[model samples]
Target: MARASATPRSSAYLSALSQEIEKKLQRALASPPQRRNLLQELFADVALEVDDRARDIILSREEDTISPADDSHLGQLCFYDVLADYYVQAPESGKPILDLIVQLWSQSFASHIFSLLFHKWLFEVQLDNPEVLLRYSSALAQGATNVFWIDIQTNTRRFQSLFCYLLDEVAVEPARLNKIPVQAQRDLYLLLSRFILFYNSGDKLDTFLKHCPTFPNAFLIGGPTDFFVTELADQLQKLKVEPVLLHYLSNLKVLQGMELRMATSTRLKTCLYSFTSPGGPMYPTRAVRHAAWDALDLLFPLFDWRSRTLHPVYSAHLQRRSTA
Candidate 1:
């Protein structure tokens, strides 16, 4: 995970940026009354998209050459993206910032900063102490969960790269996944399960399901597929954003042939059915209802077919309503 060394000029620019961040954190620590605001501002600074001018300076090299597409695959570069790489290259330089973060751990946006900056370090650095490793791992999971929820609520993909790294590099990669404690590993998988589709990562669903950790309640939940469906169903119930809900319903087709327990299947069916009607529980919009019906048709085709055969009147009723 080591990054290429930056040139002296770019390195200096990043060092100054780091100093600014450290200063803000230090100020936050000194002023109890303003700690929350300082920390929130710091989070915003790191999360802000890197502008064209800043991007050029941070990425400059001694050779006077930088690939225009260096960060293309990563979507857009953010301040944290450069800082995270800087910390990886110079871990010692980040110690002061890390110390400040630990002191303000309980404050808002603290974990978000930690996750964004140290996610790679957490995996790449060797922690001989199990207790420390677990603590850091827990913070990472919590921070990631918070930020992912931000994306869900706003219906944006701002945190998609973060999700992709955790899913692609850590969750499915056994060597890295095992870097954390078993409990943290399980928690991370479950967190990813809930937000997988929100981040447009449904393509990784099969690999993700294969790598799911064994849950303590597997006897009740069945297995990976069942646990995943259960989480997705619960997630579907909680979503209020029309676009995100439609995205979930559209992606639920991936579960069509997966072998789920009867209870799990029923739970998913009930969750989706709640969205198919314009009623109190779900209050799905017209678009969501149509998407839900399409999902139900894909997941449980025979249910509709059987209902049509046994109760033609009900089938016609649903058909008319759905078209309307």
Candidate 2:
């Protein structure tokens, strides 16, 4: 994705911000005992929501002055967001920070900072060294997974833009997706599958499934749709948040007519059914139970036939639930 060049004023402010980050990283590198603390603090600083004062300076315009309070499109902007762009514009400016990150790679928040700031750079630049490329790709996947889970656990869209960029820019773009190794590509796709619905990217479902990477275990897991549904079903089983679960259930309508393996279909069916029941196992709330029923009805309208075709005891259970 092409980003507009920052204005001279914003560029200078971003340069200062970059220097502050680098100084902290350098301190971390110089003091082994303080490395983790310093890196953690740096990560927190970059992740902070851009305040009004910082916003005005970092996003200043040539013609009109930007209002600190005018947070129409900049509400979600963070220091990392500005710095990420800064690094993209001046790749050299980020080399020092990147080197510091590599030295402190084992510490907490190191990968998080790298992923947030250099996600675009990782894909945009060409790395000739295979080992280095693999390491960076692995780090990107690991870091992205960590941040995405934060969004999931809090049921917040704080990282929605990040997810969108990975999906829209990296996942779908062949050239960009191919930049990473096969293993990393597979990992990236799997990671995206689990959170796609959470981030409300169901509209891109068709495109996403179409470009899914070829997994070595395709025979075991079936095709792209099957793998995606399997991941999604597993995600459903893990979701404790009612709103996020319901959001997922509601989005299952998109899977209506896709052909899936019988086992894969059963896996999804069993997952949704777990929530439909009132007790034990899933023990879903009333709202979730109803939503699951809706999803089941939409995905498997003919599932009722299974009650009659199966054992009498199971048939009675289904009969009672239908009336209940």
Give one digit per residue, the lDDT tens place, for model 1 in 1-324. Answer: 335467777778878988998999999999999999999899888988889898778767666555323632346777776777778778887889988899988999999999988887888777889998888898999999888888889988777767877998899999999989999998898899899987778888999989988789899889999888888889999999888888888888778689989899889878877887787887889999889878877887734454455233235446655463
**Which one is best on TM-score?**
1
Pairs of colliding residues, candidate 1: none
lDDT of 1 at 278: 80
**lDDT for each residue of candidate 2 in 96-142, tens digit (9 for 90 to 100):** 88998998788778888899889888888777887898888888888
Where does candidate 2 stray beyond 4 Å? 29-37, 63-75, 302-316, 320-324
The TM-score between candidate 2 and the true structure equals 0.89
- Please report how far candidate 1 places residue 11 from its true position, in Å: 2.0
